[model samples]
Target: MKYTTMEQLLLTELVGAQVINHGGIKVCLRRSENIPSMGGATFDHVALFVLDGTVVEWIDHLNPWDIKSITSLKGSETNLYGSRGAYGTVLIETK
Candidate 1:
């Protein structure tokens, strides 16, 4: 559960963000935006969960707001997510 310096740097970008590091994994509290089709609705601050290690949905129904959480991924990290990660990704643990 150890994050590399690079990871730490990424997390730092999200100033004023609440980051919970659990075994290398990083989860930040982020605010969710409204989905146009959903009638411009908004939800409470959601969790942007980042999975640990070298890698990285209902997510479709959710309209993600500005990624005010951790910093956006770059280079290889971005490649891991493809177009979906074009902006950034939040790893969530289901189960």
Candidate 2:
């Protein structure tokens, strides 16, 4: 399947995340309800990476062939990330 950016994100990471699909698709990562709020600044971080695994980087532009593998976690798998998992987490290995 030709994955959209949102689709790739969902596949590569962020399980248990709440997704809203209107026109394209919008992912509002579900943070813990009891953790208070960050006033919409939560998950607003995106760093571009071509290797070394990644977190919410711009993978949309990358050809699917460029991705070697994908693995993720939720509810206490490395917190999700090996170091800092989200409500869910996935690491995309680049080729």
Candidate 3:
């Protein structure tokens, strides 16, 4: 839920939502923007966490449309994970 100033700016200023790459190393400012393939990686590839604490690599493969409902965590929000969360994290709650 916490984000850096830049991350917040991207979310508010961008015309569309943002997405992260497979390795969680890059952030796409707009939904239409394409993130290059990371060798078999799925689209919207960020660290995915469910309510149960299970983590997933990419949400696109599971269900492309599901990305819309995910809550993206970036910057300082990822501090808890140290290096693994350097890029960012995504939390998805399944109903």
Query: Over the stretch 1-95, how does candidate 1's per-residue lDDT look in tens digits?
Result: 33344335345654544333333433333333431223223333323335433233222221123222334443356566666454445553322
TM-score of 3: 0.41
Q: Candidate 3 local accuracy as lDDT?
A: 0.45
List, residue by residue over 49-94, the lDDT tens digit for candidate 3: 4322465543333433223345666678878767666545655554
User: To one decimal, what is the Cα RMSD in angstroms of model 2 from the true structure?
Assistant: 6.7
Worst 10 residues of 2 by lDDT: 41-50
Give the per-residue Cα lDDT of candidate 1 at 70.
36
Q: lDDT tens string, model 2, 1-95?
A: 44545455554455555443333333444455543343333233221232354455344455665666655444555442444343444456766
Global lDDT of each model? 0.38, 0.45, 0.45
Model 1: lDDT of residue 28: 33
On TM-score, the candidate that comes out on top is 2
* Residue 83, model 2, lDDT: 42
Provide the TM-score for each candidate, comma-separated. 0.27, 0.42, 0.41
